[model samples]
Target: MRLRRALLVSCAALALAASALAQGWLDRVPPEIHGEVPARAPAGEPLTVRFSASEPVAYTLAYGGETWEAVVQNLFVLRVRPGEHALVVTATDGAGNETRVAYTVTGVGAPAAELHVTERARAGDPVSVRVTLPEPPAEVVSVRLGGEALPTFAADAVEGGAGRSVVALGAVPLSAAGTLDVEVVVRDPFGRERTLKRALEVAAEARPVQELGLTPEALGALSDENREAEAAALREAYRGAAPDPLWREPFILPTEGVNTSAFGLPRRYAVSGAVSFHQGADIAAPQGTPIVATNDGVVLLTGFYPIKGGLTVIDHGGGVSSLYFHQAVMVVTPGQRVRRGERIGEVGSTGLATGPHLHWEMRVNAVPTDPLAWVGRLLP
Candidate 1:
């Protein structure tokens, strides 16, 4: 009996020791928090705050008189009004240990914006205006050059950098010379607005004149109604542009051919003695020669028209577009995405052409600009 009693006592002692060891192994330290949050955030916009803890934890965040609870592994987002805010966060571990942190965040007003443009530009030259802001804007209201609205799109802050800026594109008309005003208006996330303005000096350059002979039948084929219809269709296409830039590299020549006519040249029809300025560069090539897209873009329009023949227009984003006219056949359809140098059509004299050729044109906000100037360089 005594031996059994001693054995029971020894078993009781071993159980107590195991219980003590288990209690000593329980976690007791609170999680250590680490990460960063923006000292200043845009008013009325969601601001992402990121942080991590040394161990698994559930946290409650308090900001702008509101509280949010979550099992956060990395980050959280909150919106604050225009003013200073005190952000407090409390973390709890599985062992019931707690860690608390506090931070001060300032909600800023409308962001300041600046306009970038060249002080001087030449007639018929493509003009690009860049607007830089401290933060991404809610919307770009308007970009105007000489009282005319331009095509605007979102662009990278710098080449090969993060996209955080807006770019406006237009051309100085052939008749425009002297000083021109540039204006830009933008809205912030909180509905706040800001405006920027600048000036550009335009210079005129003389162009050569050429005479062309066309038969009366060919000249009278297109009526005034047909011409107006085509013009209206083109205007609609130019007004709707993709919100972002599509091309990463500089534009390329659409085809390999001999240049027969230059852009912005005065052309007088010999049969009727009617005068008009050439809007595109004419390249004489053999019929069935392959034509390629100048840059990456979405096909905006492709159809046969009274004046353009088998035409294809590609929207290169940023209010920039390229046109290929007088093609024998168009291979791409509207809404199709095309890459740079991809074949889009074949060269031919389909519309009002004296010979087989391709008429290449580039427009900034529907204003004709020099296509050759964009061939090898990135426009500002």
Candidate 2:
């Protein structure tokens, strides 16, 4: 209720309310108390109660052992569990006379909910979250990422594992690297919920949303001239990662070689004097050596691009993708499904490359991850 009331004289001694009524405020027509109790809803559906009176009055609302009084009439949204609920509304007029009303509603059942997701991610990466409940199915209420609310349409549920598991899935884009926090609200048919809390350490720069207290280095870091264009392309590429994981086993090295360039290596470009972080692991391999798909996935992109020459991207689903760059030749075409260890390209020095090498990278939400970390293990 948004009741902003003004201070007024008591006028109790004058019996002002009685006199005003005697003056015939309601003589021509009876006063009206308008609005209705919302109909019953299935668990997880929203519950709202709205009311209004023809004239200004004091109103009190009672539900679940709690009573609320307001100076003006308004709407109320209740976040209670499913079942039958009674609502009591009391209104008092200027004359000190009062009226009380009651309403009841039934709510359906929903599945129990608990959050399942990774605990760490970088900015520009995707944060995948799931609500897991028992087979019967439950409705999702709300989802929040980094304290921002996402629209309800963002959630999708899949019933699997012999109807023993119901998984509600959703994700939010993370552009501010550092800490990733997520919350999910799920309700059962009877209005019960299991809340999930997730926190992940993002292997990225700290982007302070509030600038007032930012350090000079932090400010300089956020002022990236290439941020706009790069962010857009990365976001589009990351879209492929939102689906369920398609890979059946751990990732494999694209070529028979050792890592020569480790991920997260900071470097200064001798030509541009620009500083940036290396996003992938470079494996030293002879030119024309076969490069394979790390896991099962559909080739999302192939062919040349700036920085990453002979580029090929495979979306492995589960918000994860693998990138092979600096290849001598790209044999895979866009949109082709490939299997693990399938040769998709040949190793080469391409796109700002210094020598013949395979620059292999893994991304989750388009955020660069440790390629080796996924070599033989399913992602958490």
Candidate 3:
């Protein structure tokens, strides 16, 4: 009995020691959020810290004299001053055991304006210019493009502490070419002033919608059942969440014609007070107009879709894509390679359309943006 008791005591003591040793203090907190600073981040932007652990626990993080807490599977967004800083996150389990990890923070200034140009946009292509601010309160106290005050943001009052702002530049007119100047007026947090100017090269090209064809019968069918099928196909093609840092490059209009419907304009489909936002621009061109590829890309889909009629989807690099719909003919097939200005199909009012017009649309990483913004001067 004495021997058995001694053995039991020894086993218990060993087990307790092993349990204490297994409670890894260092392993409690992850190394990434606790250790090194990210290589790049916008200056004065919020610092997002992710805390993850297998066990359910609460955590308290401290950085730059600010303390924050995170519940299980929760993230904390913290703001830090510019330059280098330190961060620490502590985790306490249900047993009151605590562990901590530390990290460094390095601040970087916002990205400078880059000249985004495209070779395919023609005179009537819809365009949009958006400027992203580097810090919160992303409001532009003052802004200008080409010595002209661009009407992008609301100029009435500033809200939050938006230290940053974005101004979307409008489109150039059809047949507009030459050097366009862009200027931006900025006011800093201390009420200081700064100006940014850039000269852009505008190359003129003929839009392809000039050759698209349409018929009245095709238009009637397009405005009916075909419309729903086309929308469903598009939604299916983009089933998952979109990629980050969507394409910001200039886009070339896919078809050529006089723009009939404008982007962001309200469309009253019925006289009974039903209205919807115009998502894309409609180019009123002749039937059988040859649709052209807007940029260099590979064909993602090609088939006689239920709603799109004959549709061709081209995937441009960097998660950017352009879709040509309601074609009278499908010249390209799925998985085909195409270059800018290449022939894809002839436009028709095959699917759901009110008339024989080419419905042109542009998407950046699946987000709908103004197509004319890439095509030259639509906005004066």
lDDT score of model 1? 0.82
Report each candidate's C-alpha RMSD, comma-separated, in the order given.
10.2, 15.9, 16.1
Best by TM-score: 1
Compared with the true structure, all predictions reach lDDT values of 0.82, 0.65, 0.57
Candidate no. 2 TM-score: 0.55
Q: Sort by TM-score, best first.
A: 1, 2, 3
Runs in model 1 lying further than 4 Å from the true structure: 1-111, 118-120, 135-140, 157-160, 186-194, 235-241
Cα shift from native, residue 369, model 1 (Å): 1.6
Per-residue alpha-carbon lDDT of candidate 3 for residues 232-273, written as tens digits (9 for 90 to 100)? 766666543222212223346677788887654555543333
| Per-residue lDDT of model 1, residues 293-325, tens digit only | 999999989999877888999998877889999
Q: Model 3, residue 333: what's the lDDT? A: 75
Off by over 4 Å in 3: 1-229, 239-250, 376-380
Better of 1 and 2 by lDDT: 1
Ranking by lDDT: 1, 2, 3
List the lowest-lDDT window of 10 residues for candidate 1.
20-29
What's the distance in Å from true for residue 141, model 1? 4.0
Weakest 10 consecutive residues of candidate 3 by summed lDDT: 154-163
Q: What digit string (tens of lDDT, one per residue) describes model 2 on residues 131-227?
A: 5556445667776777765433222222223433323223333344656667777766556775676775667553222112333443343444434
State the RMSD for candidate 2.
Answer: 15.9
